[model samples]
Target: MKAIEVRFAKEIDKSFVVFRETGKYFPCPWHYHPEYEFVLVTKSHGRRMVGDHIGYFDEGDLVLMGPNLPHVWVNDESFINGGAAYDADAIVIHFQENFLGKEFINIPEMETLKKILDLSRRGLVIQGSAREKIGKLMVKMMTMNGLQRLAALMSIFDLLSQSQELELLASPGYTPRQEDQLKGPTDRINEYIMLNFHREISLQEIAGVSNMAVTTFCNFFKNQYRCTFIEYLNQVRIGLACKLLANEQNKIVQVAYEVGFNNLGNFNRQFKKIKNMTPREYRKRLDTQLEEDSIFFNEAYIVNE
Candidate 1:
């Protein structure tokens, strides 16, 4: 077992407000919570590995995961790429069954809320009309406490539970797990890579970060993350590239270099490999879609990356 540092949020000692205004990031690393986590992505763009499924996530991404779900919010470097301050961050609210009351569901009073949380176990992603309506409730929760907090929570479930467009993050088994086992090297490796992904990072550097031999480090990381160390690094960089591509102000080749890809051909190839289109085409398609979806995701939505 690796010495994974975990800072767990305590069970709500009677439903209180939990608002986060952080120092450019989240508090805990890749750790799970006993309390359910409802995250509103304010301004992030990167991969979200929930349980075992992997996918790219960006702005306005709201996700809900069950108790003790192994997960993380991999923030792409593009947001902090010496650009204007969009304040790259996230707001996560954690609460336990006890906070909501253990018998709330058993009493039949919280039946609907129970259904919403049940749907969330499979993981629910709010989209379209419901996102705006339900998303506002999250922002409203920030300013609430006591009975008001309970009411806000109820409204959140009522709208989200009824939404048809809510997409399931994955089919299940997200990542098969045994409780006693601990998270190994991948979390530490990814944290280091995320902090220093701008330039070059070598195998020795990563191995040293893991405090292990190169061979052992390689096997440990591959087994945990389901990708070789190098592959994960490329994915992190490419995630940044996609953010840049979507941004529209930057040039294709500059984004290539900025995201740690040295050669233009290699960047184009990798970008096409992961994103399935040339950077230019990817940017074009995203811009077109953004225009079409302009009617959605306004300031009314409350999410911190």
Candidate 2:
């Protein structure tokens, strides 16, 4: 596949397009479009690549990408190999950055909206309460038309602009490049890392995989990802460790080895560095979040009854 992709949306009278995609798997290759996109993964778990950032995404993943930012959600190997039981689904919305009109920012009411659009250049992940509210709004847009649909989209934009839970996905230094210059070595490097993250990987091995000398590979990776190869590898491991910690059955020491850390002390240091908390503390927070969610849901159920 080419590095950058051009997506041409069909002509519609509406200001933006909303699409609900369901299939055995997500088939889109690495690509980018001119339109700014709002994507919600309703079901599926996989590695989601946005520009130079690589991380796993689960159900309810929501992101906004600015014009020309490259991205794709590649489902786990089981799903792609056709042995997965459940199907994958997503709700995607596409629109130009100037969808509200070229002079829309001139209005005093749109200052926050303009800022949000600018931040979308690095891509934003909506989370917490805002994610739940905006997700329902995205679904609601699918059934409405004309003014109603436009109003729904605007509401989403407004909430996103004010959201405190938004997280930027790509690094600050990430910049879009020509298709030919973007896909070759970086794509291969990312795939190699994802596939081998659970095992011990050395600089020489990865550099050989990229067909470059170790020193040359280090420079190339730092230039592209804004971080050294070891740092990126640890980030990936820590991310997976986070997911593993969420499961009550996995102990911290077990998770450390599972994600390729040779020693628990090293794992603890790296985990704390990235998450600002120890693994045990992170798990405790997750437990608290789950308890709060359970209580909230129970109360809502009783109120509805």
Candidate 3:
């Protein structure tokens, strides 16, 4: 896959673009472009890569990615299965940073919005109360026109700026690389890791894939990604484990082995280090939240009917 992708949008009168997409999985590779993206995952669960950060995402996942931030979401097998039972969909909005004119954000009235846009350079996750509020607004915006749509977009950004649950992704000092000199090796390394993270991977083997010796590979990878190779691999494994744990039918021990952890102790330790909770506890929390959401949805359906 190309390291950087150039996306061309059809001519439209609006300053931004909004649309809904449904498919077995997100089709894009690990790629970046010049547009800032706001995405709300309405269905599906998967491992998402943003910059050098790898993590799990599920339904209601809301993320804002800045221009030239490489990102991709590789769906769990359940979502990729050719069945209606496990399809994915999202509402995606794309806009340029200066869509409202370069001087618009510098005004005192838009200080907060300006700050939010700056923070989005490393990507941001919009969560908690803001996710619910902004997500609904985005859905409505897809059906709106002219001033109404622009208002909805501003409202979403306002809520995001004030959100206490806003989380930053990627690391400081990481910038998108445009040189073809590094793109091939980086893409090869990423593809190799994603394909074989379910099995044991060695630094030497990965180094060979990057066509570097062990020591050179270590230095090169750290310089390029700002994270150790092992750290990246563990994140990928843990991300997959998260998707499996979301299914109540899977046991913790089963999920551990399924994602390349050989021992339950190591799995528990690494999972806690990355997710800050034990796998069982994480499952319980998700179960409780899901049940509550189900009840709320049923009541809403009855009221509407």
Which one is best on lDDT?
2
Q: Kindly list the per-residue Cα lDDT of model 1 for residues 97-134, writing each as its tens digit.
A: 66656676656656645666765655667777777766
Over all chains combined, what TM-score does candidate 2 have? 0.74
Per-residue CA lDDT of model 3 for 1-305, tens digit only, reads 44657695745688888988788887777788889899899998877878766666889999999888888888887766765486689999998878899988788877766667776767888878999999999889877987999999889878876665666677666666565324567878987886578779999899998899999999988988898998878888887787689788899999999888889999999999999999999998888898786666434322211
Ordering by TM-score? 2, 3, 1
Which has the higher lDDT value, candidate number 2 or candidate number 3?
Answer: 2
Clashing pairs in 1: 42-304, 42-305, 52-174, 52-175, 89-305, 90-305
TM-score of each: 0.60, 0.74, 0.72
Number of the top TM-score candidate: 2
What tens digits encode model 2's per-residue C-alpha lDDT throughout 211-272?
99999999999999999999999999998798789889999999999888999999999999
For model 2, the superposed segments whose C-alpha errors exceed 4 Å read: 177-186, 200-208, 211-232, 235-251, 254-258, 262-266, 269-305
Off by over 4 Å in 3: 177-181, 195-198, 202-259, 266-305
In each prediction, how many residue pairs overlap at the backbone (N, C-alpha, C within less than 3 A)?
6, 0, 0
| Candidate 2 local lDDT, residue 205 | 99
Q: How many backbone clashes does candidate 1 have?
A: 6
Worst 10 residues of 2 by lDDT: 296-305
